[model samples]
Target chain A: MTDNMYIERSCRISENTIWLDGAPYWKGLPAASFIDFAKEAFRLLKVDYPKFYKMDNLSKLVFLAADFLLQQQDKDGIALVMANRSSSLDTDIKHQQSIQEKESFFPSPATFVYTLPNICEGELCIRHQLMTENIFLVDECFPTETIEMYAAYLLRSGKAKRVMCGWAELFQENYDAVLYLVGPNGEKEHTKKNIEDLFR
Target chain B: MVELKEELKGKIIEVLNLEDVTVGDIQDGDALFGDGLGLDSIDALELIVLLDKEYGIKLSDPKQGKAIFKSIETMAAYISENRTK
Candidate 1:
């Protein structure tokens, strides 16, 4: 790795809390439910993007983290590499419930659209008009080592100028996301240790 | 007519996820799509499902939705005329 390689920025969202760059960006938000908390966060951000209301809980958590982390920058060819434990399980349950009953079988298109975890990548790309390399990995835990290696490879190969990597896990009402922007120069090292430490 | 418009407004807000909007915010003549209420194509599909599920009014053609869903006034009129349930 080059000596100049580092993490440019980072953001985390969990429960009713939000943190940016290892500091509290927003706190004391409603802890009622993830849906309620996401709504409250969307309102607080004052963003006019109506599509946010259409996203599932997992996508909403990841989108909000990306919104806080990368909204200021004008970036292109950004690679998105994310991993999650739950892997869209919450949405899968909702989608199953929607089609389970024969008497009340109703498969909603909106809910079905979010069955895949990578839909968050599509949502983020849509929000920023970014058409770039993106992948979503479902693992038992935060796969920081895999992310670090992948991001470094993409950067070194010149496939990506920057990498937005993180862990966005959502199951039921519990959610945790830690997104880091990795580039040639920053304040934090773009290593597995630093990425895993940021999640805590 | 007034009651149907109010009901349509409530359903639109609920189904379309217009959390910040209220029935009072929507007027009878205001356009439901584009600039008036800022609804998109996905919302159009949800409204179609709402018609069949809630009122038993099935629309077979997508083009018919444009005229029927022009405004709350038109939607209430179409539902009142065609709803079987």
Candidate 2:
């Protein structure tokens, strides 16, 4: 039954470019920074969510990738299993810097809220109206095996109709995301080899 | 009063990262939260930090934010009276 799960769609964001289903979807300026790329991509996608402007960099990256992958699909009962290496280090550094100096210690709630990596998943749930199970893992690299196993379990256990799984890593100026949807219908089966190939 | 209102608007935009919103778009009487600017609780917290860092005003009670953050006009007025720096 686990083998019945298939890869419905895939989207990747890295090197200031977006790739969907193994084809280049959008490319930003070569010299643009990650923030520049995110902002430009948001405008290009015409996303109407205003909270996107306030999200930390990691959340923004995850939101963009998930938004791209989940488009035109029924979003009901979709669980999320996301992995990242940095684990919100980007915002943690900012928070640490703000509190390091006693004289200038002022940590805003906006920045403090994103210190946890899983807040990115929370943002996705809020945006997509998904009230299903979600898991966020910190790994040195993409945990393809773990994701596939967990996604299969969720699908087999009847916990979710579909599972959105992938890796979204952002530390400092470096960022990369590979998100794909898994469900009962698709041409490609959800396997370690296929997931790894899609990530690459 | 006018100068303080304008300054508060700029700081709000900068601190909240309202990239799509300009200071000119925020009216002095417009609500800062809910339907007007659509700001949420996180923006409220940022504004608290902004008041402390920039105006030397500390909000010890969270409930006070409801009145102080009602609008740019209220915020400017409160800062004018309470700001130590």
Candidate 3:
């Protein structure tokens, strides 16, 4: 009944944890203080966290998910459709708060870069060399059927033989990820409807 | 002095995420860039931050860091000369 689903490779969360370390539970989350928020994602995904260089928190999610998918996906070109309530609202707030007092205003180069939500997609494309369609939507929650339908259309139309489609959401400390490998259902007529019904 | 250089090597390997490098892997005058350790610009920026945080030196210009960071030897020399703390 609710179109509250999306695919995900990973969902990097805030260190402002509100629940146990394992289960996906939630409460209000404090604003992320530094790029350290990425450490949460890396710890969950079990990737060796890079020691230095400045890839802010948002880039961390995009880069890690992209790397994971690239290694595992057998595809041609990449088509991505992702949903978010709003793009980088927390980062935008922090950036504005920084420059509010010109004397103390330090536009934190790190925070400023993530003010646009689509940057995550761009970061992935750059990392994986994906040159294809990427659409970022702002929705209160994920739109499930539309997500699969669109991803299917791309695959069926031969735009991409395989698509890494899903929802990667980070709201406060709550995070959710569902990444799917969509194609012409091997051997059997593994209809797209079956794939779409996965959430059901 | 030798202890400091060795410490610097360990920090460099740790900070750059240089997965295949080690203290013995790094020689006193071994080149750190362009084929020796294969570090690039992003690694350079990390080293700049390291200079500020660990050695009390600030390198605002990336170009100026070339000779100063030619190797662990050059880095220690510059740090010994310019470090404020």
Candidate 4:
């Protein structure tokens, strides 16, 4: 049996700047509080949820995602699978700059540890305090088959009754995210396949 | 001095994106950080740049800025002392 589940809710965010090989122009987008940014992320997915702040970049994203899933899904044993291409280029650059500037320069532990693109899942799980299976993937494009494969594996394994598989793609400057919830009774109208079909 | 305070108020509003605060709202010694204008560390850095760029006074240590940046009176005093402009 597979243990993969599909998305129940989703969100996406995009900025006007091009993410060619580095971070966005910090001045391009309107200044946004962390909560406001999460709100906008959810707005892109056409979903709704509560907002809170005081988290660093990765933690903040995971916090909102877990919060959304908890409110909508009553089931436990959930998995969070996410995808991002360049990992955390923003923090990586910051770390390198610190090292290059001075002999005694110390790399920020916080920034260095979160440089992995997949750590976003662990951040979300830690926030939600979820001990379920977590996974991360890096891909060139947001492909449906990739997510569908992992999610199906989770459900069949019976390790998790539900899965929140999210596709978070960040190009040079463009970002798009889509999350799906799939489960045992997922064949119903509100299932992941149905939502994906609408997009098609 | 009053005109100087007024001019400083205008600059602060323009630079900080205070949005709703106005000259009338900011007393001469009213706190500019934390409880006053809700200015945080980032805003403090911006204000530091403002001092250097506009007044030609550079502050390498941000912690030192807390006291000197108390209000219009304090900021004006510091700028008046070190301002190359």
Q: Quote the chain B TM-score of every prediction.
A: 0.97, 0.97, 0.93, 0.91
lDDT of 1 by residue, B1-85 (tens): 8988998899888877787799999999999998899888877888888898889887999899999999998999999999998
In the order shown, the chain A TM-scores of the predictions are: 0.95, 0.97, 0.66, 0.67
Worst 10 residues of 3 chain A by lDDT: A1-10
**lDDT by residue for model 4 (A102-194), tens:** 644544444466567776677666556668987877776554576677677777877677777765654333444455566755433334455
Backbone collision tally, model 1:
0
| Model 2 stretches with alpha carbons more than 4 Å out | A1-3
DockQ, prediction 2: 0.88
Distance from true location, Cα of A167 in model 3, Å: 1.2
Q: Highest DockQ, which number? A: 2
Worst 10 residues of 4 chain A by lDDT: A17-26
Q: Write the per-residue lDDT of candidate 1 for residues A1-200, one digit (tens) a residue.
A: 35357999999998688998989988744646888788887888788887788888888999889988986786787889999988888999999998799967666767888899999999988887777788999999987778888898888888888889998988997889999899987778887778778977
Candidate 3 deviant stretches above 4 angstroms: A1-73, A84-128, A145-159, A170-174, A186-200, B19-21
* lDDT (10s digit) by residue, model 3, range B1-85: 7888998999988766665567998999989998777776767766887887677787877789989889999998888888886
Per-residue lDDT tens digits for candidate 3, residues A52-130, read: 2345444555555555455555546767777666567756877799779865544554456678877777776765677
Model 4 per-residue lDDT at B80 = 72
Model 2 chain A scores worst on lDDT over the 10 consecutive residues at: A1-10
Residue A196 C-alpha lDDT in model 3? 47
Pull out the clashing pairs in model 2: none
* lDDT per residue as tens, model 4, B42-72: 5676677678667777798878898988898
Q: Which scores better on lDDT, 1 or 2?
A: 2
Give the candidate number with the greatest TM-score: 2
